[model samples]
Target chain A: MDLLPQLTQYAFSGLSTGAIYALIGLGFAIIYNSTGIINFAQGEFVMLGGVLTHFFLMVLKFPLVVSMAVAILVATAIGVAFERLTIRPLKRPTPLSMVIITIGGSIFIRGVAMLIWGKDTHSLPPFSGNEPLVIAGATVMPQHLWIFGLTLLVIAANKYFFYYTISGKAMRACSYNRTAASLVGIDVRRMVFLSFAISSAMGAMAGIIIAPLTMTAYDVGVMLGLKGFCAAIIGGMSSGFGTVLGGLLLGLLESLGAGLISSGYKDAIAFIILLLILFIRPQGLFSKAQTERV
Target chain B: MKRFVFSCSLFVLILTCSALCGASQPIKIGALFSVTGPPSFLGEPERNAAQMVADSINKSGGIKGRQVQLISYDTGGDATKAVQLANRLIKDDKVVAIIGPSTTGETMAVMPVVEKAGVPLISCAAGRKITEPVNRWVFKTAQNDNLAVAKIYEYLQKKKLNRVALLTVSDGFGSSGREQLKAQAATHGISVLYDETYGPKDTDMTAQLTKIRGTQAQALICWGTNPGPAVVARNAKQLGLKMPLFMSHGVSSKKFIELAGDAAEGVMLPSGKVIVADVLPDSDPQKKWLMAFVKEYQKLHKVEGDHFGGHAWDAMMLLKGALEKGDDLPATIAANLEKSRAFHGIGGSFTYTPVDHAGLAKDAFVLVEVKNRDWVLVK
Candidate 1:
């Protein structure tokens, strides 16, 4: 009944939702870093993950874990196809053209998804049962723990991959200086494709994982993607840690605002506060010591 | 020139002869429903219901031996398209009356067009604004939101649950219901202790629920369509917020139950009698009509007669009853429809007065509880 318990509940819920946004923000970050093009279809990949899993689980009668894995793979394949079919073979493509193409790609994906799944909302069974774990009167769902555990694990894996692995080094090098990396005999094109593949899988996994907590529908991607992009912008787009912070900040602000102020003005108040916070460090909440300005 | 004049005179004579014979023109009804969009779930069944009713009417030799023709256009949940369709139905088809435009947004959009054209429009949307101004030619079959609020408040008063928390979606349906909920609560001797809202597309509602849990409220009322309300149900369950949860009729569908799964158990909402048609007592006036509708609709679509379809059935029946009582002229039909009181149809028993174009009574809603993923009548 105390203020502490209510605050804890809001903060915990916010962080859990923020973790999903962080995964989506990372998807944006990876695609942006490698190609300098915002893959507007990031949210659609998440939708595809959730919807395809539902299709596999309910219609095809596949086991849940297998269906989830297959869903992730399918989304990843679509990412490869998207990059290869739309942007790869372009000759002297303009920046405006690339932007339009990605936007068009997102719409196309949504249209196709509608035909396949209709406009109905779907959900996945929770990894654990529905009961929440209560701590000193605060509550958290089992799915939240799943999200936090998996997101932290993925972030750690990504950090290790980028710092130590040859492919990750090549990806980082490509982002740093594309032409120079290409001159040094790195397959810059391959790195770009790899980034798309990885980010697409991540987005889809986030969709599948968060869907148990949140209902998934054909048209949910647009709002989710827009919020994730906001998180990416507020967290330095270049830093993984900053992206997580940005996602957490956005989620917490929204939750706290909705709880304390008028729920109707939740988004408005949060965005105003976001604008104020960004006024201090326009670069973002966190900035890498040395960053090439895009 | 002489031959041309003779041909014209012959055509005029034949037209006059057919007009005298009384089998010349079929009674045309224009229907606009969102058959393929986000609100398509509402429109598809409505379209089916209208077509089924017209077919049966024509098979029974229609009113005064004239065939009944149903002309429907899918609005696809777009307000612009609904307006365009309303114009076409009025100016082109020359229908005596019009039914539907499915959702609240579309019905509100087409109201001006139908009112200006002087055709009786029976809208299937739940927004109170649809008929609040009492457009002379406009009426609605769907129960007004205030009635649903009344239904909930009536239950609250009976249970002596005086204080409640309110969570509404920040959309048209939710906002209107929010106003009505607040306005109607005081009359029922209830106080809204906490009022909250969430985005229509918001994925989490726990924080708001957590705040409501801290309030001295006896129950929570969530006003939203599917997905958001479903998430709230799950969130409330996970947070162990055991206070009774009441949802708006916006989520009166199997979709919400499916989305919420086990979490939907014990959730209550005020819904049309269509969902519990089979369970109604034989002594009830609407049971026979509701069952007939259920049989006919299921025979055609293989699905149970739902709330949306029930709205269409009521409109069609109202128009038929009106046409039988009055002439086919638009004004006469409008007058007849207004005179229609204590009329039994699937949605509810409608009683229209000059001031109230929103025709259904508070009895239109039945308090239903979710049990094992199906609606069970509570009262």
Candidate 2:
């Protein structure tokens, strides 16, 4: 009946969006850390998850669960292929060239998707149902819950992989010291490829979960990718925890700013905060400043 | 002497045949639309509708014994690209006239180029600015944003809904629409209690709607094309806002209904007769034209034609009429178009004067509502 419920409603909405951004940020962090390339196609993998799933569910008449898993797998394969076809063949490129290749790859992927699925926006019905459950007078759709739950699961899984599993640890080591890790027989290139595959899988999962709320279209990857990349940079490009925090903060700030100030200024508000953070906390909020070896 | 005479006769026959082929060369119409970007819902239909009109006209016997040749380029809703394509159409393809450069942004962007090139450009975009300044080379078939605003206010006055909130996108189309909305608000006795603008690519607009909910507005008018307006409808229903919702002509498509789902029910918008083709009286001038277009468009695209498509149909039909009335020269064709009067097309009867290049009347729009997820004529 008052401001509290409204604020809570905005907060819930913010959290749901934050979950998607976190997933995207997590993808950005993994790829950026491992290969030092900001994979612009990271968002496209997420986009492919939704676009391919929509195609499967609507056109192919595939069952929901199968379509989803297949979408994720398809996106993962595309990400792996992106590395193989675009990244690997460049034989010894300058860092800027690699970044440009990813950008080109993103544009190419988008154009292909546009051809397959025309530029109109397509939507999937919410998983379970569309009805909202009221909590403390704030309406929350079941899809929001799905997004939140999946995001936490992804984060926990990534933590376990990086901390406890050998493959993830090797990938982390490659990011930390590629030359040293290669000397210690880490197979740095293989780790880089694995990181791309893993992060792409995460992005695909995010797309699938969020597609029900935010409809999918061919050109959605560009802006969403930019936001995720911003979140990653703000969260400390190297720290997974910081990336998640950054994504959530960006989402919350954007939502609250929109609600309180103006929707027109919401994007500007987020970017200004990012710029301020970049200027002040260049090493990122939660990241430890690692000194470069001379 | 016999061999030389035979060669001279053969060369004369070849020259005559070459002249005949050149006479029947089709009129080139440059077509530009977003086709593959955010606003493709508007551009794709315009592209398809223009092509359909061209194909049917040629089939019914070529215009002036010449087929219509359409050289279409996908602008992807980018203004800079539209300008480049316009130049290419003028310089490279050498189209006699340009039909579209879909969104208002692209239309405005390419206006100067088309004007400077001295080529006729009949835009499928609805920004009033296209024709207001009256560029000698530019014309438009899309109803002016102000005319659409007037149509909405006419319905609102009848309903006695005075206080309204306006939410528009921050693109050229929305900005221009906002100007009309504000400029005409006082004239219509509609007090805009809350005004808001949103990003074109934004997926959600609940924050703006929430702020509007706090106002004493009797109705809400959300002006945007495709996904943005659809999102507003969904968000309004999600928040259970009690105020009646209205939309601009931009969301006059089945795509909006599909995206908004149940949320689209009872939401009104001012659109053309394309959606209500079956319901129109047989004697109505627009009926036959609308029926023919709907049949051809549905047959081709496997979807219903919206107002965006109608805009293209009108523009192409106008250009076709001009081409038919005048010679292939661009200046003559532009003059013939300026002389258009009582030419009934899909949108409405058009009358163009030297001062007014856009031919459609203010009554071009009809108020329609999404009832049971279908476009229903509002009585």
lDDT of 2 by residue, A1-294 (tens): 367767887787677677678778889888877777878888888889889899999999999899999998999999999998888888785679999999899999999998888777888888978666777766667888888788778778877888798888887777777889999999988987898899888888888888877889887787778788878877888445678788888888888888888888988977897788789987677776743200
Stretch of 10 with least lDDT, candidate 1 chain A: A285-294
lDDT of 1 at B302: 81
**lDDT agreement with native, every candidate:** 0.87, 0.84
Candidate 1 CAPRI category:
medium
Under CAPRI classification, how is model 2 graded? Answer: medium
Any runs in candidate 1 off by more than 4 Å, and if so which? A273-282, A290-294, B1-23
Q: What is the TM-score of chain A alone in each candidate?
A: 0.94, 0.95
Q: Residue A253 deviation, candidate 2, in Å? A: 0.9
lDDT of 1 by residue, B160-214 (tens): 9999999999988889999999999888999999988899988888889989999
CA-based DockQ, model 2: 0.55
Note the DockQ of each predicted structure: 0.64, 0.55
List model 2 lDDT by residue over B183-294, tens digit each: 9989889999988899987866777777777778999998988788988888888778899899988878788889888889999998887888898778778888888888
Report the C-alpha lDDT of model 1 over A24-115, residue by residue, as the tens digit: 88888888777777788999998888989999999999999999999999999999999999988889766678878989999999999988
TM-score of every model versus the real structure: 0.92, 0.91
